[model samples]
Target chain A: MALDTKDVAKIAHLARLEVAESELAHYATDLSNILTLVEQMDAVDTTGVTPMAHPLHMSQRLRPDAVTEADQRDAFQTNAPATENGLYLVPKVIE
Target chain B: MHDQSIAELAEGLRARRFSSRELTQHFLERIERIDPTLNSYITVSTDVALAAADAADGRIAAGDAGPLTGIPLAHKDIFLTRGIRTSCASRMLDNFIAPFDATVVERLAGTGVVTLGKTNMDEFAMGSSNETSYYGPARNPWDTTRVPGGSSGGSAAAVAGGLCVAATGTDTGGSIRQPAALCGVTGIKPTYGRCSRWGMIAFASSLDQAGVLTRSAEDAALLLQAMAGFDQRDSTSAREMVPDYSAGLGDDLTGLRIGLPAEYFGEGLDAGVEASVRAALAELEKLGATIHDISLPNAPLSVPVYYVVAPAECSSNLARFDGVRYGHRCEAPKDLEDLYKRSRAEGFGDEVKRRIMVGTYALSAGYYDAYYLKAQQLRQLIAGDFRRAFEQVDVIMGPTTPATAFELGAKTDDPVAMYLNDIYTIATNLAGLPGLSVPVAPVNGLPVGLQMIGDTFAEGRLLNVAHRLQQATDWHRAAPADPA
Candidate 1:
């Protein structure tokens, strides 16, 4: 299960991160080492064991449908990188 | 004043010997003088601290003070502090001022605790050593050349250095306990859901838990009592009632069943660390506790399981940090994809990028079951080991780390070497059990920590055991020589 540079590049793209060409080899090697470490899990017999999602056994607690938070758009938007007319600004996706 | 415990400081405030403002100023001055070498604080809010101190004084003067009234503490930068910069020790959030307080911050503030500002941490709590921090690593207070175990390194160093009475820290995987051990302080990562996660930046939502680093177990109990409880805002917040942690400090450890896991003392454990841990167990035995040999067969796989699970969760959670909404943004993105990719690449550090990629790979279409699902199932086995051990023993005792603090840059080049530093402590996080690290003895002039693990919501029992140890030995009282 060795990870090559192509595999590293594909994963980086999936993660929405742009890795420099020079760093891809480094990442490939590092990711391979990590995979080797985790590959030990494959040896464990997990028959009939339910996958633990959350550490606590409780199910998600639901709240009543109501307006619980005050609108703070102006305060929240102050930290945005770009905004116009009460909306976040991103690059144009439309042709 | 800098060396006083939180309880002692609260007592002084009640007696009017000194106001909170005076106390805050004393610590601020110490930070100004001492932090240059330690690099423990990312932000020191002098104005905000003084203002909060003034408010605390008003409460004391009006005869309306709680146990933590007028005491000052540092936050681990991961917790949001309104109108103050919360960097999480990353360039991404370098300029991000939190719009609201984290539940831990709000609760402690309500108890009249003054803010001493945010401490440094590993970026997004990703690394074991503080070296991964965007702002340089926090140096160990005991020996400036070594690291204070992280991502709660700054909190550990601050308390150990006497710059603050206590500080807040979060442990996703031994972040609180490992650093506490290396710096020779007290730190506890309570059972998952013991503290609310709302507004505390998520690393791995399931594993991440907020806890405290302090000078003594009694101080940790006092602070944890204020921080733990249910919060509706956090979907995973436990609905259990919060107990009075300080009330159980006097409970005797007689007849206590302590489990010694043979797997923890196996290969890679430093001889010096092992000796100190054994000595600590002997002391507990003299206090009428019984030690039993136990085995957690799957314990060795904890680090691998953590790397897969934590990174997978981090990859999902960090997707929100695109260039559009907030945080570091790349300039002049030609397209939406460019905006996202470049902004993230430039904003995140190497370790963060590594994890994001690893997580994305684990959760990818073809490898999902082999990596992610198998890891989850193994997580259960690791947790099951703890469940079986707890049935026979009241608590588990071991070394907090395989070795004491290592020199900076020693293990940075190899990620696997760095990951093994937390091997003994990560299993507790995976099992969602309460774990604490109390300084036991100095090995080769560096401190070693004796770790105590308890069942879910058994924080008071763990604190009681740690409290008893601190009462009998003066290891927690040892401090570094003056920097000046």
Candidate 2:
């Protein structure tokens, strides 16, 4: 169950984090240790046990399709890193 | 005046002994003077606090005052405060001013409570020792070199250090109780959904719960009464009616069935902490309570289960912090993918990055059923253990932490060692039950906390037990020798 640098790199990529090459060794060791600690779950027999998503056994409460919030694009976008003409700006996706 | 209980402050205000403006100014000045050493506060809103205090004074004059009217307190930076920086002790939110108030903030403000400031916390409420804070670790008031248990460490330190009357804190996995134990204060994490989590920044949605830290359990009850309720904004907020937490404070413990969990007292418990907890139990026995041996067979798996479940939820919740909308952004990203990856890499800290990776791996294609699902199933086992134990006893009692506060950097290098610090308190979060920590005694001049776990929505009972303990002992009144 030990995580090597390659596995750490893959996980970091999936998580959308740009981990430096030098830090990969550190993360591999740390994540491996954490995985080892959590590996204790394998010892328990959870046969036929239901996987619980919430503690209260409650389902997601649904609301009507009506829009309850007012448009405050300017206020909400105040913290955005990049924005122009009431739209968030991102790098070009098209080739 | 700074060390007085919230109730005492309220009485003094009603008696016209001091104006709310004066009380607020006293705390503001104390923070300016004392917080440099403790690093407990992230922001001190002087003008906003004074204006609120002035309004409170007007309310008092008009005979519209409530129990908490004009009382000054601090909100943990995790809760959003409009027009103020809500850092959550992370560099990502360093410049992110919340556009609206958290439900907890709105509710407490409705009570005419004056907010002194926002307190520091572990980043995203992730760490057990406040060392992960981007601002800095909140020092334990009891011993400056020691850590105040986190991620509610700032709130605990502020209350214990007499910098504020009380403060709001959120518990995901023993965040509130563990810090309260180490800092010698009172804290309670009510049943999940007891308080609305609308604007309290999400960590582990299922495990995150908002509570309060105060010098005494009576003050905790007073603050919790204002902070707990249902809201339509939070879908998971319970529709249950909010009770008068302070009303039942005087209930005697005669015939109270207290369960001493065998798993909690078994091993890894420091002898000093165990002795203090046992001594606290003896005091409860003298108050006519009966202690019974109870077993929670799955309790030992709590720490492992939490690491899996909490990190998984955090990974999902934090995905919103990409470079596009808000939070920290990267410098000169070459493309869209670079924008996301570099921004996140630069924004998050080592522990946060480690958790994100761990969570991503756990939820990945080949491992979902093994790690994620297995953890969920084991979660139910832990909850079931609590359900069965509650059937036999009214409440479960144990030490809040295995030991007193450790030195600031003692376990920072080892992740597992830090995780085990919360071993005794995480099970209650996994079970989604209410828990309270009350200062019992000082071992080697460091405070120890006795934890009481109750069934779902039994916060009043937990507070009542803590209040009775405080009445029988002077531990809660023992302030730190050094306010610095």
Candidate 3:
């Protein structure tokens, strides 16, 4: 279950992180070590065990489709890296 | 005055022996003088603290004071504080000012508490030691060269150093208790959902819990009483009635059934730490408590399961920080793709990037069943172990950490080594039970915390058990001198 540098590169891409080419091998080693540790789970017999998503075994609490929040756009935009005309500005998505 | 208990300080304020303003000043002055060495605070809001202290003074004058009124404390930077920089110690939000206070912050403020400022923590609450903080690691007050275990390291260090009366900390895995153990303070992580996570930065949502670190369990109870409750804003917040956490402090421990999990005391547990925990158990026995051996067969697998589940949740939660609405953005990007990738890479640290990678891989197509689903199944096994153990015992007792605080950079290079730092404490989080740590004894003058794990929402009982130990021993009161 050792992840090679190529696997690490693909993971970095999938995760939307730009790992430097030089650091890919380093991350590969680290991730492989972590995966090795995770391989310990293989010893446990999880047959017929349901995958638990919540700690309290509770389902997601649903709320009414009502907007309970105030429009604090002006306040929130203060922390934005870039914004214009009440909308967040990122690099042009469409050519 | 700085070393006095919260009750003592509150009494002083009520009797006008000292004003809240004066108490705040004393702490501010101490932080100014001492924090340079400890690096405990990310932001020291002197003006805010003084103003709140004045307001507390007014409340006292009007006979409108509660238990924590006028007591000054710090929030781990992971909790949002409006108008103040809430850098979960990550470069991504290094400049991000929270637009609103976290629910815990608001609740404590409602109790007329004075805030000292935001304390430092592991960046995004991801590391076992404070080393991952963008600001810098908070030094252990007991030994300057050593680390204060994290991601709540700064809070523990601040309280241990007498820089603040107490501090708020979030525990995902062993964040609060591990640091408290290393720093010789009291800390508790109540049952998940017991405290609203509104505005508290999300780490592993299912695992993260807000708690307090204080000089003693009594102070922890006082602060926790102010901080715990439900908030509609937090959908996962519990609707359970908040109890008087301090009510059980003097309750007798007679006939208390304590479970000792042999898995926790096995190999890798330092002899000294085990000795100290055993000594604390003896003290409880003297108090009329009975200890029984119990088995949590699945407990050993907690660290592995936690690494998988926590990172998986983190990967999903952190997707919001993609150079978009807020947080760090990259330099002029050629296009949208470049913007996201570069901003994230530049914004996150090595450990954060490492986790995101592990998480992405786990949730990816081929590995999902083997890693993510398998981890979840094992998680239930781990939780089930706690459930059955609680049936036979009122509480489970063990050492909070396998060893005392290691030197900074000791485990920084080894990810697995750092992850194992939390092996004993991670199971409680996986089980979503209330767990608390009290200073049992110091091993080689470094602190050893005796952890008590109770059933869900049993925070009061945990605090009471911790409180009784503090009464019987002076270990919790042994504050570290100024670290050179």
DockQ, all candidates in order:
0.89, 0.89, 0.88
For model 3, the docking class works out as: high
lDDT of 2 by residue, B69-144 (tens): 9999999999999988899999888889988999999999999999999998899999988999999999998998
Encode model 1's per-residue lDDT on B1-484: one tens digit a residue. Answer: 9788888888899999999999999999999999999999999999999999999999999999999988989999999999889988888999899899999999999998989989988999888779989999999988999999899999999999988899999999999999999999999999999999999999998899999999999999999999999998888889888888899998998999999999999988999999999999998998889999999999999999998999999999999899788899999999999999999999999999988888999999999988888889989999999999999999999999999999999999999889889999999999999999999889988989999999999999999999998888888999998576
Q: What global local distance difference test value does model 3 have?
A: 0.93
What TM-score does each of the candidates earn? 0.99, 0.99, 0.99
lDDT, candidate 3, A1-95, per-residue tens: 79898999899999999999999889999999999999999999999998888877566688899998899999999988888899888776776
Which whole-number lDDT from 0 to 100 does residue B441 have in model 3?
Answer: 80
Backbone clashes, each candidate? 0, 0, 0
Q: Looking at candidate 2, what TM-score does chain B attain? A: 0.99
Candidate 3: list runs displaced more than 4 Å: none
Q: At residue B367, give the lDDT of candidate 3.
A: 88
The candidate 3 chain B region of ten consecutive residues with least summed lDDT is B475-484
In angstroms, give how far residue B343 of model 2 lies from its true place.
0.7
Worst 10 residues of 2 chain B by lDDT: B475-484
